[model samples]
Target: MDNIFGDAAERLFAQTCTPDVIRRAEQGQPSGDAWRACEEAGFADALVLEDHGGAGLGLADALPVVVAAGRHLCPYPIAHTLLARAWLSRVQRPQASGAIALAPQGLAIDDGRVAGTNVAWARSADYVLAGIGGQTWLLPMQAARIEPNGVHGSLDGGVSWALADAERIDHVAPLETLAASAYTGLIAGAMDRVLAMTLDYANQRTQFGKPIGRFQAVQQQISEMAEQVWAARMAAQLAFQGEDGLPRPLLAALGKARASQAVPRVADIAHAVHGAIGVTAEHDLQLYTRRLREWRLAAGSESHWHDRIGADALASRSDALTYLRTALYGKETA
Candidate 1:
């Protein structure tokens, strides 16, 4: 789908998210400039209501911007901020500024405050949205004592907020499913880039005096990689399917499960096809591959969603087959 939001975001990132920018971000550089560009372009506020001074686009419309960010390996929390703004507006809370790192599943509130470890982008984010389901707390990073873990090669870290300063908003929209859908979209876009890069390399890199694309073994790996790539693409489309711009929970779970499952194999095949050169710091392959690995674990792994699906099926009144049909096709079984 050709959308002004997606098209503009693609163009914006293409110019700002160059190899040098990715390298600098991976090296722990601040992503202020790129983030400023996004903020100025009004991408984060894409989903907020027009009455709230936003474009009031739906999740389906705004997701392309997130996918574009993933395709470009955007260093900041663009998707997180988009979801946050949307949620804040849903509960009639004041529209927030600055990058908001969303912690959808991890951490909990106690005594009106939240403390959590393994918060992605905690070191760099201005605020963290901590909650489960419809209730969420927005805590400023300035009030917290941030302990940077530096894990996953990004801004992942541990943070403890001054709970008294927390802004708690109840009856907010559930974010886990929203996050899952967007994460799957990111996986789809990143895998597309990786597959394209691998294909180009296979046709160019020579082995035994011939291009590796001509070899049966290398061709087999590329074929497998292509299968997963398209599967992820299809899964993302399914995940984003919903009514009135809202994603169905079952669809989100299935999409995230399938997309997350594709990550390890896709990253492995891309590296395997390129041999040692793919992992070199100077090469661009590792940049995307590492983020692919990280995104797999974000929000929840495949196993987490798989178990959720299985449990739901078992708990449903209908048979397994009917449940599956209802989940995938939205048709109720008699």
Candidate 2:
């Protein structure tokens, strides 16, 4: 909620995450410079304790940084890095400077080794954090046999790994919850940028000797886009605020579901408004649109979170209105 931190993040991202930098990253070139700059700016360690070589900022303070990173489409494993730092601090392990990957599911740990397919960003990670049978493990990427798959949208590609006899560590934070929270911020940032681009284009592009924005149909679509972006931003803020001492799953599910569902609608409207140019790689719209779609399915899909929300609501056993109120606002209805 504090613009002090958010504004600083925005300035840093604006300076570091330039279009050239993003273009280089999109071409599969190393983005080490931007990542190092981000680390120097304390973003990589924002979630860790100061005593443990981090900024010691709360989730509220750290999330805006994530939002800024998303807005610029920073070509780094930012969410993964934040989650890894938190896990490392929790387990008292020294944090490494390289990227970290999360093994969400379809992975098994046995005899001190881990074997899994399609581990997100495993090719670039120095460490891979995984949950196994209610316990967490941190595997060294160097020890793993990594096979790179093709890229997934604008985000980095996934990898398969066979890591033998890797080490395991304890983690205090739920990786999924942290990831979902960060992703909510990322989606909000993307939508914000897309809406701005669409608005600018609508006002500048003329049809029938008048700006397209002057037309009622285009105005209505832009209005809907603005509404969705606002809703997504609010959902992300609510999720960030509810991160501490609240029902994390409910808040995360709500934020992520709302934002994810908005992705297709927002992307369609943005592309439609921009005409054929928006779909081309030459245009900047693809950068935000691709990431939005990828992030929507990353931690969990909208359908997945919808099921979780439904299950939580069913478990509450109260009227729908009361449950909705308590879930969204964290206040019980009278």
Candidate 3:
């Protein structure tokens, strides 16, 4: 129910993360200053508890903050730390404060050689949380390759690395799943921003001596976009609210499902409303919509979530229906 990160996030976004700075970050230029401002904003500490200099908020509380960052396309790793530090708490790494980046393809752990990390953002990360051989590891960033790639996506032209010195840390929960959910939440939030901007454009842009939004066809598109955004928002809320020791896969899948569907719909509406200008870099709408597309397929696509949901449904059958029923009725059945 706590939707705000106080005034910290707002102040940081307004003062430190200006539109120009964000554009630079999105264009693949890493700004240590902006990243540091993010640290100052308490984003890096979202996962770390108060005792460890964090806000001590759980995933539900932190979702909005992550979503806001996604809307702005802020190129910092808030969600990664959220996953890593929360898991590290179990193993007494409660004092950790740094950016974390989850590998989309996962890492491999082998003897004397680290594997399983593909497409990492370790260049900007002070520390790393890695997955290896069904175990989690906290390792120094130097151990990974940090392979250099262009700024085609959000990685910012940074190099990715494999976990060469992935030291297994026992008892720490894996942050991969949580990271997935947060990433999905962020995309969903960005979609909301995109739709709103598109609606505003439709309202203001006049053609044939009338505002485009006054037309029924334009209104229908805007309405559909709104519905999609609302559905994704609900899904994100479900994922956040159900983070009470629940398996991350389920919540993550749900969040991803909602977002993946909503983003494209939102993007289409935005472009349609803005016409030729929407695709231009000059408009901020493109930034949000572009990142929405990138992030939509980054973690997992719609096909991935649908398969996951289908698997869950098949495995539980009536028990799953009971769970759904419980959610509707506010009580779990035996």
Candidate 4:
């Protein structure tokens, strides 16, 4: 994974995406000030072509950055922007000046109307991207009504545009898979952070006059959580391996399916290890955990992708092992 973008994003998000900042943003606070810092760091345009005022990096190269965003539980749609900007650039659409978001699943675009429920970062985005009737559409948020969902402002939102004053950029690959692939990277990073946080808590927190981490039961849970986190990371890495700026559909499915499967287990164990504090609104654990659950369901949940993978495997007419190997490694089965 390329650390150059990730390292920069880590530093920027550390300051801009603090727990308090995220908390405020969820309360309908405008994150424009914090987002401006990202703009200054040149992260929002990292994947756009050099000619288009972006770094010209590929989606694979942006994996680490997505992970970094996940680590900090970044409220902005950094994961979406990396791919969206690159896609828009490739199609030569007019540049989006602020944070742009990708909305997948349940999106309805028809007869010049665009609508969706629980669109990620809908309240925060200045522009939105969606696959509308097999064509890429860029809809500015100015004309849309954002109905906030969840407690924290626009952690997600229900958005609708009656007239659909948006541009149909181009017809290309659906953004759902690519969005899910980048999201897996984000999930992995956040899961790793949760693991680290859980480990630190278990080690420092005392039970029966000894560190909880010293207890066999606690240790067992921690070990299980560790395995899940590392497995999720590997899934993201596998999902992100692609040549040009997009991930293979099967790889993306596998990555998202695996990572999403890990979210529930990992979040359960993290809270189990923390006892009560993990669920508290003030604690940072809830921030990451909540996002993890939402992210798992976003783009396509584990069940959704698993069904796709299983259908593909069935369609291949090969043995399970050979089908998996071919899907995973892009190899032809004998």
Candidate 5:
């Protein structure tokens, strides 16, 4: 499919998410300018309905922006904001301006009170969308007591209120699928950047008066990295190509699993190729690598998704090939 929006988003992110901008944001500085630029460009609301003051794009269309943000390590809650806006629009809730975070775990609503701990990005968000007892809610940030849990590289780490009073709204969309799709895109983008950086370094850096890439050992490593990157990107693409309005959980699980599994290997090879410089904060490689490591655990880990996939396959009594085909193509062959 021709993704014009994806193309546009990629260009916009490339223009604004420069190395200097990323470096500044990584140093605990606010990325207001970057966020404002994305907001002005309509990226922040890309997944919301047009009736709700957004671009009215599908999750597939909006996912490229998430990928681009990942590649640049854009210091914003790109995926969370997209999901929050979509959920709010679906439930006819008034859309709020500024960043929003999604609490995927540790949320409870009782007697008009909300309680959660370790809600991602709650400290910086204007609002939070959480699920409690199979019901969805939109809670204002002020209603919750947020404490900074310190930074984990590019990720916004924080703990939320243990208990707070707030009104709950009804929303039931397959948010986990959306989150998995977006996170898969992020991993794909990070992998892309890391692979590119490694390739460029391998071709340029000389050892023993020859380009390191010319060595068999280095070439083998680069080839493995390239394969992992391709697999992760393709898996993410498959996840984005949902059958209906929602992403296929099986595909999303597989994509997230594959991407998460690829992170450690990709990071190892990328850093190994770049030597000690890749780990330093001064180098751009660490930015993408660190985020890759974190994104691997976010939404769900490889083991989590693997267990889900395995359970589903066993429950359905499908063979390995059948299950793999169904997960990748969303259908069974006669």
Candidate 6:
């Protein structure tokens, strides 16, 4: 498919979506304005069909926008929105408006219960989409009691909205796959930012009367970081290419597994080379790294994705080569 993203999104990122906006998001400031701004700018409408007021862009084109958002550590519920759009489309749900997070399997639907939710973003969203017993549920955002949660003291903040059983509605979709896809894209985007920032830091920071990048050890670290990003990006792109037939669950599983592994490696290398300054909250690297770690466990953790992918592969009784080719290239030619 053609790339739907042009220069406009990039320009917007440079002009309006600055690092400070991300800081505000970290501080629990209102991101509704930013979210609306992105929606108006065509990013939110990427996956939606033209009939649904979207550009009908495929995953290939939408990947870059996700990457950009991740790079900025954007706090706008971009991933949630993406998942919501996908879930609505698959289930043919019309006029569905809300923020959606891919919760862990088996959320409790008991009276006044709000469980199994993870990384939920819609603090003020009109609705919340959740997964329960392989089904998606739509709940009013205001109904649930939101509990503030964070990751490693970073602003990996989220709320657990509790709802009574009577208020629950069953709306099922391929949520596992949707969550995996969006999470993969978000982490890959953040990985790209990590690589860029680390590279610049290496070049700018001086040591022993020369740039740290000139040192062999530092260069090796940078090379390894780049390689990790490359691996993660390739996995993400391959997953995107097979968006049609590839099971979203399996694809998302692999995407997140690779990203969870790659992101921390990249961040560790960057911080090691950048030294103590890199670890501080004030530095931009921590912002990206913290979010990376948080997103890793959001849709599912590394172990979760790994087991899911392994199970799918093992359960596929068809020819392995055919499955592989169809998965990576979108087709299998005998």
Q: Among these predicted structures, which one has the highest TM-score?
A: 4
- Give the per-residue lDDT digits (tens) of candidate 1, residues 249-314: 889899999999999999999999999999898899998998888889888999999998888877
Pairs that clash in candidate 1: none
Q: After superposition, how far is residue 160 of candidate 1 from its true place, in Å?
A: 1.6
Per-residue lDDT tens digits of candidate 4, residues 1-334?
5477788888888888999998888888888888888878888787788988889887677788889889988878887887777777877776788878887566786666788877778878888887766767777888898886754534779888865487766467458877888789999999989999999999899988999999999999999999999999889988887755667788989999999999999999999999998888878999898889888988889999999988988888888888877865687766
Q: For residues 17-53, could you state the per-residue lDDT of candidate 2 as single tens digits?
A: 8877777776667777777877787777877878887
Best by lDDT: 4
lDDT of residue 214 for candidate 3: 96
| lDDT on C-alpha atoms for all candidate structures | 0.83, 0.75, 0.66, 0.83, 0.76, 0.66
Residues forming the 10-long window of minimal summed lDDT in candidate 6 = 150-159
Q: If both were scored by TM-score, which would come out higher, candidate 5 or candidate 6?
A: 5
lDDT at 66 for candidate 1? 79
Question: Higher-lDDT candidate among 3 and 5?
Answer: 5
lDDT of 6 by residue, 248-328 (tens): 455666777887778678878978987899888788888788778777777677888788766766786656776666543
lDDT score at residue 121, model 6, on the 0-100 scale:
56
What shift in Å separates residue 195 of candidate 2 from its native position after superposition?
A: 0.7
Candidate 4 whole-model C-alpha lDDT, 0 to 1 = 0.83
The true-versus-predicted C-alpha distance at residue 278 of model 5, in Å, is 1.0
RMSD of 6: 3.0
TM-score versus the correct structure, for each prediction: 0.92, 0.89, 0.85, 0.93, 0.88, 0.87
Better of 4 and 5 by lDDT: 4
Candidates sorted on TM-score, descending = 4, 1, 2, 5, 6, 3
Candidate 3 lDDT over 18-77, as tens digits, reads 668767765556667877878777776665556656677776777777667666666666
Q: What's the C-alpha lDDT at position 200 in model 5?
A: 97
Which regions in candidate 5 have their CA more than 4 angstroms from the true location?
A: 108-117, 150-154, 162-165, 243-245, 321-334
